[model samples]
Target chain A: MTVAADQPTALIRLGRFLRDNPVIPLILLLFVLIGVLEYMRPGIVNERWIGNTIKFAIPLAMLAACQTITMLTGGIDLSVGVVATVSAFVVSSLTPLLGAPSAVTISLAAAVLVGLVNGFGVGICRVHPLIMTLGTGLIATGCLQVYQRFVIATGSEIPSFLEWLGTGRTFSLPNALFLFLPFAALILWGLARTGFGRLLYAIGANENAAKLSGVRSWQVFLALYTLSALIAGITGLLYVGMIRAPSLSLANPLLLPSVAAAVIGGTSIFGGRGGYSGTIVGALILTVLGTLLTLLQMPEGARRLLFGLIILAVTALYVRFTDQS
Target chain B: MTGFLKKHGWTLGLLAILLTLLIAIRVVQPNFGASGLESLARAALPFAFATAAMAVVVIAGGIDLSVASMMAVTGVTAAVLMDNATEGQAVFAVIAVLLVGIAMGAINGALIVLTKVPDIVVTLAMLFVWEGVALLILSTPGGGAADWLRSIIAGPVSLPFLPEAWTFWLPNAFIFMAVAIAVIWLPLRRSKLGLSIYAIGSDDTAAFRSGIAIGRTRVAAYAVAGLFCALGGLSLTMGTGIGEPVPGPYLMASVAAVVLGGVVLGGGRGGLLGPIIAVFILRAIRLLLTLMAVDPNVTTIVEGTIMVVVVMLGAILMMRERRS
Candidate 1:
């Protein structure tokens, strides 16, 4: 009270402003990082580099977007990567037989089924999200592995349309951005303007209280988790389009990175705070870091080490701000 | 009968499951003899240790996502240290690796306490950090453990008069499990630190108000968990005779075993025997599938289904208990 009433100095106000808005510092830090990288590598910010970064970051951004939703529920979807892989596998396998439209539909349906199972296990049965998703992921991966036997025998091909989707550009924008931007907008609006969005925040903040307040928490969780999985399916399709080939390892590496991105972007892993706005920036920061490190010629081990350290630093920073205010 | 079952339902249930699976295996293949059991035990032992490592932390109301990576690190450490060391030095090197495990665990505990970061986040990062460290130490996994370590971990040690016909050859995993339970887990369960861990897990605020040192106990639990993880890594080293950097699947498998063993994810509600039995049951399921010539792909599906079922059962049981 005393501090607020004192009419603080400009420097103090600036400090408070920076402290209150964590995203600005991140944006500034990203710019500084970009500047440093560009200084080291002259063509670091070229159109080609920018295009590739967006291409690489698209799948991650999608994953991070959905992960933000799940995290807002105070739960995580560890199966996101596996579901995406399954979707890609489905798309690749069925493209020859069903063509693009039906294959994409069937693949997303499978993703939704898997998500529903995860939701039932987590929401209805009240299993921990970590364990529930792990089981579902294992199941999905296992089924895919069995399915791979047939896929190997049949020799599936990536649809030409998907190849275009993966690598195509439209009006000087990467094709992936065209798919991701509107979806991101929908998610952002849903989080901000919808009753379900408020309910998600309520459930995450305190499930019991939400229940007492007449929130059908399970139904919300089911929708949230299913939505997350469907988005993962979309990510997988886009991934298949981008890479032009689908392999088992397609989305495996992105699982942790997606979570890390969300956390970095200011989404509280504990839930009920954060938005897609922060996550988009978070995803971009990670992509920028990856690009910078690659340009710098760092070894994989050093890259991972630096990655872990940065996540730790950002998490600690976030935790401090959340705790303070 | 009801009273006994009520008091030890999870234990009895797990034992019964194990027995039924074994019987099913025997009925399917009468000639599936001691060697099969030996291999099964061998494959399952490392997992059993990993499960124990997880049980310790989970029981303390914390989780260690890094144990699997720690196993890789410990394996890499042993392999690198024993590269040119002689027989006498190898034994000391194993001991040093164990200390390193404890030290790593202590660091995890200390960070959780000092920073007040959730254990899951800290250990999750450590999972990647440890894996990176492991890779840096040995990029492609081509180092060996000492000969004595191998014999100690893998050499035959069957019970007397058990069977000369079927040749009931007990692998060293049994001894490791026994030592882990008898020498480590049981004693720890009786110690003050153990009680403190339980108290904290059950209710931290109440425990703190009751004069228990929350930070120290939590750290001790994690350190103990780390000790088991080190053992797990050693077991891995002995089994493979080389360090391997991939510990991802093992991490998931261990968590599955822990849950299957009836250890609640939230903590303070289960014991070691259940997890030990769960490990064997999972291994048996895999072994049975392999023996039946079932596709290995199908085995993964089965593993996932069983994990979900076991956890669902546990959840139902908890709900019933709460309702009653």
Candidate 2:
């Protein structure tokens, strides 16, 4: 009888723990998926696979960071992909004309300009974030197309530093970790410990309340979008280094995946309840899933279909388990 | 006159903008004639349908990013099924495609309702799914519709015993759009479901408190939007005489049109007429730009700028009203 009573208590405690910490299950799910992959192909979970997954996943997670941060404020940065593309394309196109450093600076500045436009639209004009970002993204793409004509004669080149940082490996780990570790740590720390971070959560939870409390919400929005764009720009530079080519639509494919990563990581689209730690894991899961899909040898169409279906299934299951409402 | 102006102020403003655009196009290209107008109608039909579909979903407090993909899927499916088929078979294929579109949309609605996931997330996933399906149906855009179907959709209006010039002013595509609007939108707007859609969009809790079935109405809105998307697909296939599995450009254009037409993003306050007019205005602007020999890339820039300016103007007006 004592044993039976103890068993119920233990089960209840486990249940309570899960209810409190939702990311725990997501981590477990990631592991289960990995285990399944390993089961399907023995010895495929080696150091090289790990390095490659991280190499690709780092850029995606970086892009998703923009979504995570913006989503916290009940908005999204649809311009992130375009911003990344512009930064990548500009840097590549300008490197041959100017030095790498100036090219990088100018590319990032361009991203900042786009972000400011987004901020102005969202914060001051009160345009919906989706529409504002979408419009700005279109304008940026058009400008990039125009800019391409001027730089077409110059050709493109990736900076050596970015190439080293993107594709290099050290002791079975991706060199990207050198950049990503500090970046992730800062985001995690900032989101938790900083007043600005708290402001994001507050605004997302209740914008009117945040405004009533003297938050200067528009200023927050301006700063927030600029920071998001800056991150996307950085991700673009790193991504171009990894891919070793920058084109007009270089980062477009990553847009939906980044959004998916944020959503799957439990970053609520409605806003105010998520973190970067989960998004990092979400990116890893996607990379692994992509690997598995490749191994399955399915056609592109089937792979995409399964990819979408799996994302939907995982998100649905996750919400069902974690959501009290 | 005052009451009329008060009621249709936004529509009148949109019409004025459209008129200015047309005049600019005419001035830029002196030979802009009946054939040009017919081609413009032909080119704008698919997008008009897409904008209408997007407008409905946005007005219902949910957005279907998959509408463009849905159009692609339905278009390709119809094309593949109708290829070299008998007239009856082609008609049957069209019906089948419509049903498939409805089923796809209803599935979208059911998933959102069942999973309680946000509409954007679910629809985003569905966008990929539908695109994949389109790719599956037509791997590389090599499918054709029935000949008669294409003629009916893409051909000029030619009434028996009427002069060619007189009848050429009205393209069959425009008639299709009109018939669609009359047969679908007008009646639906007067129905109870339409009221519930607007009700839920404005305030779901209040709507629910008043005993409106929010879930069902939202689902209906999606279903109706899906039908419009299917119509869009049919128009595309018929106009082009083939299916193209690309939906990205169309998606952007449709969304821009919806916003340009004065539809509020959050929902509950918009109509089809404004978006239809916006479509023509957009087409006219592009035509004007082309006639002026501006770089094609500049058109994208101008479109984006116009969208931003229009929304900013609307927001400012709303602010003034609220202040007063």
Q: Whole-model lDDT, candidate 1? A: 0.84
lDDT by residue for model 1 (A1-325), tens: 3565475465456556755676887888788878988899777587877788778888998999878999898998899999999999899988887887898999999999999998898888888988999999999999999988887866677777777878998765688887888988998899999998888888888889999999888899899899999999989988988877789878978998898888888777778877887788888888998877777676676776677767777777667545644
Could you give candidate 2's per-residue lDDT for residues A1-325 as a string of tens digits?
Answer: 3554568667556555655676788789888988998999999999898899899999999999999999999999999999999999999999988989999999999999999999998899888889899999999998999999889999999999999998888998989999999999999999999999999999999999999999999899999999999999999999999899899999988998999999998898888888888898888888889999989988777788888888899889777656632
lDDT of 1 at A143: 95
Off by over 4 Å in 2: A1-16, B160-165
* Docking band of candidate 2: medium
Clashing residue pairs, candidate 2?
Answer: none
Second chain of candidate 2: TM-score?
0.96
lDDT of 2 by residue, B272-312 (tens): 89999999988888888988998888988998999888888
Best by DockQ: 2
Q: Clashing residue pairs in candidate 1, if any?
A: A166-A241, A166-A242
